[model samples]
Target: MARALLPLALVGAFLLVAPPFLDLGWQNALINILIASLFALAFNLLAGQAGLLSFGHAAYFGVGAFAALHLMARIEDGLGFPTPLLPLAGAAAGLLIGLVAGFFATMRSGVYFALVTLAIAELFHSLAPHWQGVFGGEAGLSSMRMPWGGLIFGSLIEVYYLTLAWVALSILLLWGLTRTPFGRLALALRDNEQRVRFLGYNAHVTKVIIFAISAMFSGVAGALQAISNETANYVLFASGVSAQVVLYTFVGGATIFFGPAVGAVIFTLFAYLVSDLTRSWLLYQGLIFVLVMLYAPNGLGGLIHQHLRHRGQLDWPRLARPYAQATLGSLLVASAAIFLIETLAVVFSRDYAVARRDAGGGFPTYEVFGLDWTPLSPVPWLLPLALFTAGLWLVLQARHPIGALWQRVRAGSEPGVNPS
Candidate 1:
């Protein structure tokens, strides 16, 4: 109980502190963070806990959003209810759809299961635009939030608080699920389904239940999004939405309970920051994902967990030199790559051509980080290439020392091992 209360307390503290520091625009962004966090958590519940990789979770989220929109439309016509309870409509829609979809999808595992989910989502995505009456075609649906009792949903702060409450509730519920017997079984299934089956568990049934539960929460997130925006669109059903949640969950470290939530927060903030500075934000996201996959497969959470687990065995003095070398080498290589990629992207862009035309150009001079160099000039290209090659060589040279240090740490972590 105390362990559970800790998260609640932390959330309460955050809710108290965050809004005062942020302006209206940032407050709206906070709402997005809450929604995305919930979505990522829902995805993690299945993929991380049950070892089921879904490529179509957005279908449930979109369905829930549409359902909530319909409900709000009805409520506008004398169906009396508090605006706060709107997410329940989404939850119901997600649960119903998840039950139907999971029944068939959960029958398969591995890549087949992922493909099935993707197909189901794509089916909905295709139908949503054409189903004019329900999905509202391309324009989608719009509904106004009616005042419920004394609490008017007129203000952004009110909506933020409401979202915060739902987010906290959802997180607590999902965390509680992880501590239950079913959660243990889900972890078991993730490790070895055959062994679980041999132990008399019905893996199929377990999977469907987990899938449905995950969808239920995802629907709630979609519903909250609908409420926050006062509209729902076909974009909600897009594959990109599903992909975003998956990326967030994996990058946050799906194996940890709060990993996806952390990932969502970080990714959302990073995107917000990068989008303002560059049009090539997607390129940065891709780079981060690639680097994380290569160096830290378990993600930020996994990296932290590893350090904590092996803290006692880690020889700071002995390993410091190699760690620094590796880190510096990786940074240099990444910087060089980023410089080269961004320069190439700018050189080939239509904007570059337009600018050239406007300037009556013989050739375009690119100004990057205070350095002005034309693409036709070999100096700009050669500098980055040389730096990249040097960094790569440094990384390779440091690899042996880093590996040896890691081996020693691992050996020291074992029982009856002497560091000396």
Candidate 2:
């Protein structure tokens, strides 16, 4: 776990400096990663550590997000707390709701438990759209920055740092929770509920506690998401969101401490990359998930850990060369593909036809750099298409040698083989 913490701490430090170097696109990507990672960690507390699988954890998350959004919107209207610390109130609401729900749901374990949670999620999903006063109906709730120590989060980058702070605090607390005696007891409860009861431990209360803690973290995540996006809707409570959270945690390697975080980064980057390339981006996400599930049960992070353990000693410096090469190749291919696809869309757009028919049409003219064109020429589009294909080939070819070298190095043929 300490080994895991080192990498995470370094990553957090890097994030502190990342905003200045990145544009809005990358900052948005990081925000997605942070939100997903927090959500996964919350789910893991229930499913991975406590042996309680929830199909509707999004109930807490959605409620929390809505709670924060409502608070932000109503702060001026004099109904809720200030926006900066809104997550605490949101978490409190989730905790209270989780406790009530857990008491009723934990009466029966296994499939019954999952069903009860799912029903609760469905109930909330139905209510959000109808309860216009609280949920904002179809339009949802939109929020603006409230006064907070003279720091207004008007910029997307500002929201990213705020989310980063929330993520760090939430993860730290969850990590510490896992090290406590109560956490150990929860593990025991997971292992054998009957045995735990026989030993005089109240298994129901243990589960309820775990459920509440999980809900609390989920609420924090939701609140951060609400702040980042400034929008809360009924869709957040949908079954799809719950399913995505489950998939994210499971595919990331739930058993390991930091696996979910690694999974979040990979999943977010893949989504952004795919959505930029093809209209049917979901198909690509499904395919990647299926492949990861089949080949890497422990997830990408787990695979790395397993490989390091096999070497008897883990060293960050050793991974730099191969990781850098692989990462560089991936970025190059992804960028080229996105550039080609977006350029082609403009070059052959129906908007171009409309524009040509009426030069002063209501439709905005397409432009890039300083050139406003009625439509892009085929010649300009072809250059990028050709380059994209070449980049794809180069990246694929580059990875082969890197992989071979890493395998040989990992197999003990390399020097500095610290057989510690």
Tell me each candidate's RMSD, in Å, in order. Answer: 2.6, 7.1
Least accurate 10 contiguous residues by lDDT in model 1: 3-12
The lDDT leader among the candidates is: 1
lDDT for each candidate structure: 0.89, 0.79
The candidate that wins on TM-score is: 1
Per-residue accuracy of model 1 over 259-378 as CA lDDT, tens digit each: 898789888988877788777888888778878888889988777767766777777787787777777878888888878877877888998889889879767687777778888888
Q: On a 0 to 100 scale, what is the lDDT of residue 297 in model 1?
A: 91
With a 3 Å backbone cut-off (N, CA, C), the pairs that clash in candidate 1 are none
For every model shown, what is its TM-score relative to the native structure? 0.91, 0.74
Considering only N, C-alpha and C atoms within 3 Å, which residue pairs clash in candidate 2? none
Give me the runs in candidate 2 sitting further than 4 Å from their true place: 1-5, 78-82, 313-420
